[model samples]
Target: MSEVYAARRTRLREYCNAGGSAAALVSRPANVRYLAGAAPHGAVLLLGKTEDILVCGPSADRPSQERPDEALRVQTLPGAAGGDPAVAAADLAQGQGADSLAVEEHHLTVARHRALGSVAPRLRLAGLGGAVEQLRVVKDEEEISCMRIGAEIADQALGELLESILVGRTERHLALELERRLVDHGADGPAFPTSVATGPNAGRPGHRPTDRRVEEGDFLSVCLGATYRGYRCEIGRTFVIGTAPADWQIELYDLVFAAQRAGRESLVPGAACRDVDRAARQVLDSAGYTEGLTALTGHGVGLEIDEDPQLSPAAMGKLDACVPVTVEPGVHLPGRGGVRIDDTLVVRPEADGGPELLTITTKELLAL
Candidate 1:
């Protein structure tokens, strides 16, 4: 809604004013979308002291589904020759008499930042930092609703995959099929690259799928998420390939499950982000499997798959209500393959409920 974008921009403008900037140029796609309601390719949002404008380059097809907020003016860069929208936005900000314009240094390239300066030397360029991302960490109900739907789609895809034959399928095929199922279940697409790790690759975080085929007695781990209406949620599970799991397999699965549950249970308002990681990491460390543990037990997820409030030992932040994060702690034992259980959940007040689980897929170590 236009009102939603307006409110978000108002908040961002307040942040800019607090930082002594008269205007802000949002060039990052996610930040632009968060503030302007839509970010077409090469689109940049200018939150000015007087007028908020969405600048776009020439495009054959505008994303009609993601219309810019009616309250904001949309300006296309002039002429048949395409130009950088951020540069044009800076010029517009200068025209509006904005003395200083804050920009996301992390998102903008050195060349692009220099281009903005070239266009409007009078407008002081200040670093916007991660202000927009910080604002996005705590989501509204509407954003959480999209993530909930995405989690459901991911669970449905994973459930369907379990019912299918997996005796000899390649990891790449499995990953692709899961992604297709995500779309079939009404997802815009997979939130991130679908990971299907088999055998020794199981429990390896961010492992790219390869030609390894599923085989009996191998541990299979799948990490996937779905994007629903621009919101994302992740779910990961590890399963044994045979009708029964070996003793070592059972032990490893149970240990990882406990660690994941500990991390999930720690998703309460006011909990320190690192303490949550400690809750999960300690489980593996005590079990003598600390060497190959993932750097973070979990991370915040929303418009971006991995955003703010990182659940790592070195992280510094507190979880707040409506913050959606994934507790994905895993251990990889090199040649033996290991376990990883992950779920996306929204932190809520204890009176209403504890963390709300979006991904309902069973954590039981399923033996396929």
Candidate 2:
């Protein structure tokens, strides 16, 4: 793991060198964790010419579970409280004789950026852009294993919820229970908020759980994920409450299921991101259900639930093998509700059995 973190930093250093910067400062928590193996609160990674350093705030202690790589130097800024680690890292870079520094312009604020320059006036600052994010798009086997474990935890949590009594429970209560189950099953936490929507609220993407109680003949939708070892994975499923699904419910579920399947099938190496979105979206669009559809059919997931390679009509990029992404598509009718089917999958070559499905919860529309 130390070697892995060291190798990642070396790659970032090479990118900075190619861009003519002597060092790089990573302030984004996710990016910091990617390079340093852990991101303390208000911490930054300084990939200096002399040595890579994990700069921390005065009160930023390393998490018990996520320790910094032994190969990297850890430094706490000299202060009692409240100082930007990014500024301190820049000062350190200048002290190390780094002529120029590359910073994540997208993640830094204007005020913070100015403070970095103020602290290191002689050191040139360049935009690192999304270099680290680009580097993280494809997962190594270890990273994938973390996500796979996270997916399993999520599946277990959701599976347990399904086995319990769901009727008469409020959406919020069910959501809370699901989160608790995730932690009980060895998850660091829920990757994102557990969404449990009942009745008309069902199938709305990112719908926050409400106090509405589940009842017979209602559409119950749930979307959840688990974070294991900093990696995240998501899964969503819709079920009919206490009765066989009606004709309309069956039709909508099947349509959404087909759309999700198409998106999943299109996740191959070299496939365009937009094409994958179209593969799913077109199914809904052809059914005249495009009005309330979400902008994206799916997106990549990793250290963050929502990462790069967005599966949207306007997204520009090509899928690569080992990139894990979600294929979630749905249509929410204003008052009638809708259906959503989502799964986390890893893109792989056909010779490797195509896209690897990580979230293995049943996609079959069940009457719960």
Using all chains and alpha carbons, the TM-scores for the candidates as numbered come to 0.98, 0.98
Give the number of the best model, judged by lDDT.
Answer: 2
Cα displacement (Å) at residue 343, model 1? 0.5
Q: Which tens-of-lDDT digit does each residue in 207-304 have in candidate 1? A: 99999999999999999999888889999999999989999999999999999999888888999999999999999999898686777889999989
RMSD of 1: 1.1
TM-score of 2: 0.98
- Please identify model 2 stretches exceeding 4 Å from their true place: 79-81
What lDDT is reached at residue 157 by model 2?
A: 91
Computed on alpha carbons, the lDDT of every model, listed in order, comes to 0.92, 0.94
Name the candidate that leads on TM-score: 2
Error of 2 at 362 (Å): 0.9
Cα displacement (Å) at residue 152, model 1 = 0.8
Q: Model 1, stretches more than 4 Å misplaced?
A: 60-64
